[model samples]
Target: MFRLILEEEGYEVHLSKIAFEEVHEVEKLDPDLIILDIKIGRHNEGLLLLQQLRMYRPTMKIPVLICTAAISVIREQEEILQHKGIPVLYKPFDVDELLHIVQQNLLPSETKDC
Candidate 1:
């Protein structure tokens, strides 16, 4: 679903099944933005991945959007993401909202007209 939506907006999207795969792909692709589901397969694994990214200098400045449905659990980690200026999108999100967020993250600062 996410891949399709992103592709429709002209962004090349890659899908990774697990945290390890995601890290591998991110290193290989150096994507303009990363949309991560906060749970991945293990509880908080996505958050763990984000923490690792923060520690790594090469990937530390890349934009990230934390996607999740577990609002209650997310509230606990909200401050962490907020402090990093990472955006959060709850599950069952509208496509338009998703597209808008993607564009905002991927567009260069000089090119952002919205």
Candidate 2:
């Protein structure tokens, strides 16, 4: 759903169903931004992957946008995510809101003007 929406908007989107194994490939992909969910197959895999990415050099700077339905989990990690300069988008959001957040998180040079 997100892939189709983003692709229609002229952005290349990559879907990773299993983020843990693919986390290593993220540096190679070198995407301008990453939209992450809190639960990826497991309860805390996303958070763990986020930490791992942050610890690495090349992938650390990539912008991350958290999109999840786990409101309680997000609230628990809100301070940590804020300190890391990451933004969160609650689930059931409008498509326009997603696009807006995506645009905001992308590098200025990479953003496409609508």
Query: Among these predicted structures, which one has the highest TM-score?
Result: 2
TM-score of 2: 0.90
Residue pairs in steric clash, candidate 2? Answer: none
lDDT of 1 by residue, 11-108 (tens): 66777778864455566667678888888876778888888877777788778888889888789988977887898999989888887787777755
lDDT of 2 at 103: 88
Model 2, total clashes: 0
Q: Candidate 2 — what's its lDDT?
A: 0.84
- Scanning candidate 1 in windows of ten residues, the lowest lDDT window is 105-114
lDDT of 2 by residue, 15-36 (tens): 8886757567888787888889
lDDT of 1 at 28: 62
